[model samples]
Target: RMSTISSAINLPTIYALSTPPGQRSAIALIRVTGTQSKYIYHKLTGKEKNPVPRKAMYRNLYMPGSNILLDSTIVLYFKAPHSFTGEDIIELHCHGGRAVTSAILNSIQALNDMENGIDIRYAGPGEFSRRSFQNDKFDLTELESINQLIDSETELQRRCALSSFNGENKVMFQNWRQTLIENMAPLTAIVDFGEEIEIEGMESILNNIKRDVLKLKKEVQSFIERIEKSSILQNGIRISLLGKPNAGKSSLINSLTNNDVSIVSSIPGTTRDSIDAPIDINGYKVIITDTAGLREQSDDIIENLGIERAIEKSKRSDICLFVLEADSSMKIDESLNKLLLSKELQDKKVILVVNKEDLIINKDELRTMIHNLNNEMKNQYPILPISCLNQCGISDLIDLLTKEFKELSDTSDGADPIIMSQRVKDILINDVIFGLNSFIDCLDSDIDIVLATENLNLAIEGIGKITGQVVGIEEVLDVVFANFCVGK
Candidate 1:
């Protein structure tokens, strides 16, 4: 299938707007690649000869067979065998106006209509990256790294993706494959022949293979654990706001997100459901959920349901913001007190947020109240005072959240390597774990040597899937490349 895809790259030239499609930017990038790139470059530029490879040339593009000027652009050409796709490539750096981009694209497509012109078509999503993979410019893992780097929303995501893109993960996987192949050699020899081959240290070889497999399994499991821990960086951290009615939870949500995503109202029980607003805090993605405030009892069915959802969301959140109105005379409500003491929220990072601080003149009373609550709760939860009306202390709140987020999402250590691709991680978790465990089981029991060899083969193939070392990888390639944007 790979060879088939590689051979199909010979004829039609593919082009697309490599940059985002919009007029917001000052410039746009158009990429063309395949066998007819040189011809297309010369024809569009009205030059008898193609420009020097890797050199930029200023040219006025024109519709094929017509003198209609398309745009004044900076063009570049890359000769085959050394280009991104291992084929002739052309780049048109044109104005970002929609009309200009559309006109140039239409003119490029017109090349297919010429009497002796080569085939030209728009590039599909990830087609450029796929071509790079097919041409040996990159492997599946590196291609995945490129996609992750493009989609990354946090610093950790970028660092991990860049590390993998630089071949750190590839080198690690290659070493594992080599180890598997080395161990499999002795086992394969015993399995191939029905009769026991007279070999020295047969028992010793089997024992040594078990030790190696055990060590490899431990390493793989450790990596899996690290992947699981760091996955929160990819998926935003969840935060739930819990407090009494009209305690300014909604206001805090709006201030945190800098958008009025939740309705703010003075009347009690205004929020009847959980409202989610995803925000980026210091490059850390966070999902802040504004839940219906907790009360001792609610007659309204909808309000009751909202309160229930608040509890459920709080239980699942990584952080819980327990808002309290600083000016209000009422103490913590019965339901809120019950929730604070509940085992479900005990393990979560609960911060006592004193809102409406702008209404208070003296800080001593508020401090006494916080001190009392801390003594009663015995949790010593971090307390932050903020006034959403004035946006006071919001930055400090954000900073605190960012600090906690760093600790929660930290995957850095000198020993463990990071795998950013979910595809690769899934392959490791589902396929590699199964093979390794099965092989170990076979070795531990009085199972057949042939069966143990087959299990080892399964493990090898699973690792091969990560770096594209196995066969029948067309489906894997499709999934990996699907994450990319058009012309990437």
Candidate 2:
């Protein structure tokens, strides 16, 4: 059954457009991978002569079983064992037009039907990447890195993904695995051959193993933490504007995004739901949300629901901008105080934004209000006085946000590679850590040699799973590759 499933997964031939679809552009790439890639290329191009491997050739694509030209394209061929997916691969770089690209793809399909019958088919999501994985071209980490690179929208994200794709994490995991196996060798030898072996410095060896295992565990923990923080950098940081009615939350969002993403009005409760806008602030992606204004009393059911949603948004946000009108009352309400001080929101970063600062008659009064609010909070939360209407102090606010984001999310200098996928995290925690713990228990407890060796083997296998040295369960592979796009 397993062999059948594996065989089904490793289809004979597959093709996909390696580029995004759209109107006419400079170029579009279509990739094919299989043992018969060269044959298919010859048939499609109607060229009797074989093209040199790894060299680009200009050719005219023709309709299958006809001399009608589809499009003039650049073609390249890669032979088996030296190409992506470890198969004979063909890449067609054609003029990027809806009609031309589609016609070329259809011609390939037609040729497949006429010659190979159902052997060639359109590639599924991540199928090319999965094939590369199955063929030993790259490991799971590299495959995941490729996916991350494709999905990356920020500079830091791209750098991290590129580093992983270059096998930084794989090399780290491999070294750890090698160290583990070497550590386990003495224990295995002692188990296989009794005291006759007369192993020297057994105590020292065991102590070294223990220290290494502890160090590895700490490294894994650090990787987990870094990945968690870097995720905020990858997915834009969420900052929600939360305040009372007409506190200039919408105005601030509009100013920040430089567009009327949210409706601004003098009347309260104009924003009945959270409106999110993603803006690039100093190259960092910041998702600023304009949430509904909080109020104690509302006759409208929708307004009450909006207030509840606003509270929820504030609780979940990475940073809460508590906007208060400087000219009006600067008191934080009981409900707002309760929400801010709640355990759920205690760890969240708070920035007290005193809006409409331009309208303030007395600067000392504004400072006094901010001081009182800080005293009530019992913490020195950074306060910024800004006029959302007049665009005053906007640059300072942006600089503050950028600094916070960098402190929280920057991982460029870190040596440890980040683990992006939750599946990888689960394997590391449940399998790798569990195995290490089991092995360590055997060493510390002076358990039977056989049991210790068995636990050590389990630990080695767990490390193998991380680097795809040992193919994981089918479900795990599915979860890992499911995030990839069809062409990847």
Candidate 3:
């Protein structure tokens, strides 16, 4: 049903540059797809015969009306049902130059204006991918995976996206859907022939449905947990450095990024705002934020405002590095300790960092102080003694962070595909889970078979939304494809 609607609305030939738009590269690829794709190819190449399907041929392109030579290009043709969009397709590979690529695109537009009976237009963002979905080339999850693959920044993200694009999620969804249908079949049979079914067989079928639902519920819960954990990998892990003035917060940021991302000064409250520096940590993207130092008694309005911002950043961060001076006579600030114990930071992971370790006269005394502080707070947060000035213990800090990140991102034990989109989760929870619960309740209460089957159908439709099998909502496709590039 959706395929027919898509085909009806998308009847014209569409074209766009499939490669990044720039002049630095050696070549650029332009893709065309539609029923009239062969016509457009012939007009551009001035060849009566189309190039062999799936074969590249060298040809000279020309302007449609004046027959003016444009450029010598390599062209490939694909017949319907075999191309990316499952339509007649043509690809032109031309030299990557500001003038050459622009001239080729402009010529195609000019031909569209002069031609009759066939329409050709530039593709919109994700339009190529949308067409592929419409033609049943790939499901919605696979489409999202392709977009993720393109936008991937880290090795783990790339591998996960590639796994989804290769039909990992599709296979999982199919198995779930089949199990659901098998369970629904017995309920449907009971509804159609209520009295004709044997009592023992009915009891067996009901038991089977209950067992399958329990198993599926467990699997769905596990998938949700995996998604939550893998989210740190999908969106880079955020670590915020927070402490009182002159605690080496800025210095630590500079050391991690190896650049002057944050200004380091001995003056209190030198940093008035949060500065974010993104760095690659062992194939994972980690964003470290250097925030304004916390202070209890600040007469300066700007300093107080900076402290407020620092607290807010700490609340949102995945990990908070609470820095302290190893040589200072004062203990941790009472106000800062209270803030760390507040409800806003309940979920945040805290790590104690004692800076300027080289300045400490006694190592055993420093360790004793840290241990006592941990006991006083009633939390055994990992403490690392470091000297930012001497670059001591920086490697140890990195190793600790890497270990934490690996624990959060590990997915070796599960066979279920990762769910990347929050929209998918919303649908599963609000629609699929709700419908499943309704059906299960109906069965447990010995409700009408018709009502139970109706709820079961609703559950299946909800699951179908994930794969674009039953497209009740057009907005779902719009949202999914909106993130893709124009040529995808």
Top candidate on TM-score is 1
The TM-scores, one per candidate, come to 0.86, 0.81, 0.82
Q: Which stretches of candidate 1 lie over 4 Å from their true place?
A: 1-11, 22-25, 113-117, 258-275, 290-307, 328-330, 390-392, 411-419
Write the residue-wise lDDT of candidate 3 on 390-470 in tens digits.
888888887787677776665445443264777777777777777778878987897566887888777777778888878
Steric clash count of candidate 2: 0
TM-score of 1: 0.86
Model 2 poorest ten-residue lDDT run? 260-269
Descending-TM-score candidate ranking: 1, 3, 2
Q: Write the per-residue lDDT of candidate 1 for residues 1-33, one digit (tens) a residue.
A: 332355745457899998988666789999999
| Residue pairs in candidate 2 whose N, alpha carbon or C atoms collide under 3 angstroms | none
Cα displacement (Å) at residue 482, model 2: 3.4
Clash total of candidate 1: 0
Residue 486 local lDDT, model 3: 81
Candidate 3 regions with alpha-carbon error over 4 angstroms: 1-10, 20-26, 53-58, 97-99, 113-116, 194-200, 259-274, 277-279, 289-313, 328-346, 358-377, 409-417, 471-476
lDDT of each: 0.76, 0.73, 0.74
Tens-digit per-residue lDDT, 71-111, candidate 2: 88899998876888877899999999788889988877765
Regarding TM-score, does 1 or 2 come out ahead?
A: 1
